[model samples]
Target: MKKLLFLLSLFFVTSLYAQVEKVEPTFWWVGMKNPNLQLLVYGKDISKNQVSINYPGVKITKVNKVANPNYLFIDLSIDSLVAKAGKFNITFLQNNKKFATYQYELKAREQASANREGFNSGDVIYEIMPDRFVNGDTKNDFVKGYPDGTDRLNPDARHGGDIQGIINNLDYISSMGYTALWLTPVVENNASSTSYHGYATTDYYKVDPRHGSNELYKKLAEECKKRNIKLIIDYIVNHSGKDWWIYKDLPSNDWINNYPDMKICNFRGTTVFDPHKAEIDAKGMSDGWFAESMPDLNQRNPFLATYLIQNSIWWIEYAGLSGVRSDTHQYPDKQFVSEWAKQILAEYPHFNMVGEVWLNYPSMTSYWQKDAPNLDKYNSNLPTIMDFPLHNAIPTAFAEGDGWGDTGMNRLYDIFSQDFLMANPMNIMIFGDNHDTSRFYTLIKEDFKVYKLAMAFLLTTRGIPQMYAGTEALMTGVKGSGDGVMRKDFPGGWAEDKVSIFTRQGLTNDQIEALDYMKRIQNWRKSNEAVKYGTMTQFAPQNGVYVYFRIKGDKKVMVILNNNNDKQELQTIRFAECLGNHHSGTDIISGNALNWTNKIEVPTKSAMIIDLN
Candidate 1:
């Protein structure tokens, strides 16, 4: 399947002795839109040598020697149109004579890698924190040289879940009607503590040995492809682990935002777009370190910026990724991210990437989307942004009673009323909860009625929907308890566990009910095109009943939410515009046929997903 099989295995080029310590992206693919390739050559006195490449269609455009003599930024121009999948000898010279030869490779890309269609509205994303999902292999729980280890008893400690764990659960996920999968950062987070989240990247080119190898990660993308599941990788460009290899040996002080005396960030993400914000405040938010263990990257540095951009592209190509979830999207230098996204899109036009814009208002969140018409003329070039505004409104919307003055169902109406402020409303990434937030089940006080209502609205609403892991089994944890509690291990993930979500064993009554409800709606959503790509038509809420219609070419799905206590109805005439000539329909959730001649009786604190006939 590869033009050059040897190209797959990349090692340090040892000509007599090892001179090239690191080269990233370990390997590159030909036919890339960008013809230039900058190889970060690191070794002892490596910059003192002359860089020369003896291969057709590959030329050393410029070899830049940095302040650190061990580092050399070798720029090579590869003619994509003329370059074939082959190897070239990059000969390092001392006094015009070749001393060391490093064999660099340009491999053939997978067919249509550039044209890969990303995860969109049609796919329901099931997000997984790999370390807490399942422990398919316990052998690599504690790899030598990796300081952290797993402790199942401690919520804050690692639970030993790995890539093989996710590979083992693909069928269960696919069977549940989740069409796409998103794994929180699998890049090496070799920190001493709290590294399971994977946001603090240590080695960009290597996968954490405890989690799995790069080979297994590629196998995951391949396996997911076989199951018709699109894979999205969580990426963070704002910072890296404090113990990163490059950090130990600096090419320049500007490589990191704040070097020896690092200042902590205020986390005022709004300052990036705040027109009236003070320059000092903006500097504190952007240039300051996210945490003591994480070093903020200086995107203004051309070499560092290119490293971040190339790393993402390499992952996308190597792992066969469908989409990217840019973590801490608002924390980075806006201009660098814009160019980073621009270069990625330049290479792959159809590729989709969502940013975790953790803003509570649509007006602010919309500013990060690609085509947002901001007065500053700064476009993020991001395809989608997370719906934090709607997420903030959901728990309160379902918890309170109706007609309580913007307290109950009216909360949802108010949020949707501001959709006009969004750049692309349909492209929003909506979710009930994620690894960073409190469990959705815990937020609504474990109310089954509210659970069903939230799930129904999420699946049937506009934009792409993302479900956090273990939501089906009614997983409960508050964010204040610590991130590890909210991202607890699944019952079936460990061998010694009494309950198994896979086999439906040892689950509580409420958990069983929640699982059944989740399975039913998720599986039903797969085949329904109206709910996926259809236009949404929502009627103004009246009497605590919020009604919306998902209408495609000919298919229609009517979703009704009754947030009141008892039963309330007589709403046929109000929805006649979307109901059309159909007088009857079946509720997808209850599987009961209903009449809609004059009025329909709606139950309290429940949702009805009707398929009109």
Candidate 2:
């Protein structure tokens, strides 16, 4: 009889262990704007059991079950006004018999979390691909269970950069006058190869161990906060890695867009706003997978939509993020994107979100911004959209000399003229090049003169400017060489690195000059109110020079770009409306006193930022 009892006990224990496997968002916080919480419970036939919560001030509003018996989405309503931080018991019952119990906790939020400020026009964002930026903790470089390991020699292989590396260099970033740091996604990307980019997310809630733990990521944010630097997470909502848990054991066939067939995306972003676009084309663009390895998420499914929305909010509240850079923003369902932005903004009113809308035209890009006057009457509710139109114009403008309408500075002038279509042009995130494109230095053909000109325009322009990690250090790489070439490791990020730009050691004179020039302009921009939140007045390109003024209440900044191969005299009389009574000013770059009454001599392929005193 004792042996029989022992066998029965063993069977019961095995059944209990098999009941539940995972509970996402392991814990939540009280006092959230939205009291409705959805807890995704994953286990073997866990959906077959009825769930209930007996905790004080917490009620199980509903239990949703999908076609797959392995999943259960439990909705809970926490009384935000009176909910206290404590552990609560969630019981799972099968056939009126207790099978498994989950002890969930609700924590108190940080002070002023809902009112946390996001990165804005007053800030300059320094974009870094963590894997290529630095490797602070070599111990976590090659994690077990992950197929691909670090191989710095191969441009396409992981180079072992981690969150600790970023934390270690917070001082370096802050000293450079950058107010915000935007890292490419650090989420778990357990792909067989090319996982260093961090765009293909395998786990929504966990940071890849190779990058660092989720705790380390939070610590990175805290460290950034101490240095007055905001962290902008590059979030991907359109797709997930093929190895994603949900992809392996989908809750339903509709969990992913294309499912077994895996239709590659059309990548025609313009179809989103094409009024007369065919229904088939629109569906193909939105429903198509980004790649074979990245499965497209079916945001049209309410469960998946809610899951993604909650996951984003969870990260913001958990990590204390300043902002979010939505990857492939237009590829997701239009309505879902609108709702996602609206909900996030509703919770954190001061937060900012910039979407990656890769359209080459200003009008189409403008249509994605919040409150845009779209003829189709769709509101994206997204505060910012990337300035791809300006991005396309920059290289062309610098490459060409003066022309009537389309060449030289006219290219930029024509682009900015359509800023009227945008609800708020200043909110656009402007960058010369990013990880996917050729480096800015290479785009300008490694010409330091043109590089300086591009920097001046980017920093002084009427938008939030972002600079890639090594751009200030004169890093050059062509996109044709592949993305890994563009996102090469930062020199001196590793101890083995012979040359470190982080310090002045082992740098060419041109590199040092570029670094110092960038620092000076960036620091100057930090304190200048006119450049930060001023109204812009740009004059047409004349004699190969593009002149613009950023004027606020009592402050004014005049920027001149001479793109010619020869010196040009900029007439001061034409800028009388902006120059006003100011007879003299100091050039921020050369520290020369300018006589506004006479023509200003601008050198070939040079830029001048004048403080109108």
Candidate 3:
């Protein structure tokens, strides 16, 4: 009898251990605006058990069991009665017998967490792809568990840039006058190969060990705070890497869209807003997988939706991030995307979130912004969007010579004229080029004149400006060749590189000129109120010259883009409405005084930024 009892006890313990395998969000915080918290519990036959929490001011509002016996979505109401910082026990009962017990923690939020300011028009964002930026920690280059390892020679392979690399080079970024650093997703992309871009996330909660630890990411945020630089994390909601733990053992069949047979996405962004679209096409666009290796998540599932929403909030609270850039924002279920944005903004009212809506038309992109006048009553609640239309127009604008109407410099003016469609035009993120596009330097055929013009226009424009890594050094690459070429490692990031643009060593005169010009404009933009919060007035392009002014309060900034092959004298009288009483202005680039009384002479294919005093 004694032996029988002992054996039974051992069996019970073993069964209990296997019953509760994982609890997502491992922990949460108290004092959140939303009292309701949902915890996703995964284990063998976990849903068969009843969950109860005995903590004060916390009540088990609901225990949701889906078709999958391995998962349980436990909802709790954590009111003000709970202690600011403490651990509570969650007991699982099956047939009135204790099945398992787990300890959950509630942490005190950092001061001013909810009020953290996000990146705005006043900020210039420098976007970096970690794996291609710099390799600061050699020790983490080849993490043992992850399938892919570092291979600097292979353009598509991971180059092993880590969080430390970014931390080490914060000074360089700050020196360039960037107020924010937006790195591509740092989440673990434990795929077999081609995982460096970080879009395919295998682990949503943990940072890639090869990049660094979660603590290191938090440290990076802290360091950035000390330098007055915001950190914007790239987040993907549409899909997860095939190797994701949840994908291997899904909580339910509906956890992923089209679970058994992954259907490739149509990549048609218009279906989301297509009033006359077919159901099949819409489903193909939303429910289809991003790639064979990336499984599209079914945000329609309530449990999964809550999980993703909580995950985003958890990261924001955990990492102290200023904002998030949602990757492939339009591919997800439109309603869920709206709810996700709403919840995030509710939690952090001042936090900013920019969605990557890579549509070529202003109408399509504007449809996703919050409060857009869509034909359908859908509001994404997204505060910001990438100005892809403007980005696409810039290269063509610089490439074309003086023309009759809406050509050359006029193309730029035409693009901005569509700003009325945007809910908040200044909130849009404008860029010359990004990691996914052909480098700006290469797009204009390496013409230094056009490059400077593009840069000046990007900085002085009416939206938040973002620049790709190595843009200041005139990095050149064509996306048609492959993304790796465009995302090449930054010089001086590696110790043995022959050229270190970081120190102005081994650089050509043109490269030096480009770097210095960018530095001058960006640094000056950092403190200029006119560029940050000014109202813009543009004149019709004439003789390949485009002129505009940014006026705020007593400050005024006039910009002239001369796209002609020869220097032209721009008639200043045409811009008198913006120039007001200003007769003279100081050129930010050349430090030369400009007499704007009648006309100003601008060099060919160059931009002149004048501070009207």
Candidate 4:
């Protein structure tokens, strides 16, 4: 009879309360720069309970219960200086009776984690769209209830390129002299369609099972470390997938902007900084949903703000990432995103994060960089901004010969004249083409000479250079047909592929030559500090020839682009300012050492790079 009574009591306790459904961050570490931490607790009727933590140096500063009965935002003051790495119970009670208890752990951070350096100008970045890269595992091709599954024939569907795909190709990647790898979002996306892009995130903490588990992602980072490659994650904070757990059951209506009757964003980054802009225009850019499936986040909501910020920190720590590439960076709340960057930098001092400021003009892109002299006194605190202005100008410059206003080489050099608008010009990231655009070869009408000229210019330019995966193979696609065509599968990534770019099997002569040329230049770039860190000096367009010099303390390299149809004799006397006391140099491209006699003959539609002696 006593045993029956004890069993009945145990049943009552077990049935009455379950462990808190979710504790975001699940755990945290001691010795963080910020002593305060906000934990978003989600569970059934969780708001009705009183919360208490029993841990040394861990104090529950405040417990916030929103309109939702299932969500609790608990603020804790973690005195890292005194907090020991251990676990303790966080008890939830109702009517002074314990109902739920969660055991949370505080961990010890990795040594020197705070001092980890981010990707910079010294590194050449290889940008990849993972789903189209390779199929590393077939088992994860179709995750149950994920909506989108592997379909190689369907350009918009997932193709089963897991993190293991990236791990398996580290050799090919590093062999191309790429020091940093930037992949589009690998986070979980449960959207019904076109989920291969990975921008809409359903789960922030978990890597999409379709891509592989979060552990596999960390393993990818570890493998990259073995090969001296830095991993940069493409992170999105502006909005989340409509299927996101938080979006489905919002903690509060304001957690997401324009929740039920959401409006589309104006897609104008200028609205954020336009002094004469209408309030509606500014709000439209910030509050409007990025898309029907991407519900915009309200960073103004302190709880949501803390959630996003903490998530960024969590991923950086958990994955050991070198940097973050924030997608749709200009769409979030102004002041809140500023603070978001502030907090992340406070934790990782030397870290670098580039904003995706996809503006048409340099002024617009520069405005979001770390320090721009804006009339409105706005500072984005973003370490780098994509050089869209230059990327837009390059193909046009290479494709068109001597022409009017900002045409030909003029279009290329004219963009740099606006450099005064940039606080740090070196922080810009330049790319000839990316996943969303037409390939460089396609843009140049498949002119191999022009392709080499354009690539040589981008590689030798003043900013950090990022090359999209298939650029070297001269992959061709036009952007107007849609992103699907623009982001085609990398040849030979799958077993069924007829030809593999990986092994140079059955490649066209142009494709093989382009690949070898890019490999040569990129490998050489790895050793040339002048091109990476030197001050750039450009010469005015002279008869379809553009010249530039990258000069360091005593190191100098000269780049000449001949966009003409005839061989041109470039007078050396005109570049005396850049050629101080040097009469001879080795032309690295041809491996020919030439002694200048006031002029050098450069082939038409070709690039010449000289290492000064």
Top-lDDT candidate index = 2
Identify the runs in model 1 with alpha carbons over 4 angstroms from their true place. Answer: 1-17
Residue range 141-181, candidate 3, lDDT tens digits: 88888878988899988998999999998998998899999
Query: What lDDT does the true structure give each of the candidates?
Result: 0.89, 0.91, 0.90, 0.89
* Candidate 3: stretches off by over 4 Å: 1-18
How much is 216 displaced in model 2, in angstroms? Answer: 1.1
Query: lDDT score, residue 292, model 4?
Result: 89
Q: Local error of candidate 4 at 215, Å?
A: 0.5
Task: Give the alpha carbon lDDT tens digit for every residue of 1-613 in model 4.
Answer: 9999999989876654465788998789899999999999998999989999888899999999998998999999999877899999889988998888888899899899999999989899999998989989989999888878888888777777878888999999999889999999998988888999989999999999988998999999999999999999898889999889988899989988887898999887788988899998899999999898899999999899999999999989988999989888989997887888889999999999998888999878888988788888988888899999999899888878777777899998999989999999998899989887888788889888888898899899889999999899988889988898678899988898888889999899988988888888888889888998999999999899999999999999999999999999988999999998899998878888979879989987889999999
Candidate 2: give the clashing pairs.
none
Residue 352 displacement in candidate 4 (angstroms): 0.5
> What shift in Å separates residue 163 of candidate 3 from its native position after superposition?
0.3
TM-score of each: 0.96, 0.97, 0.96, 0.97
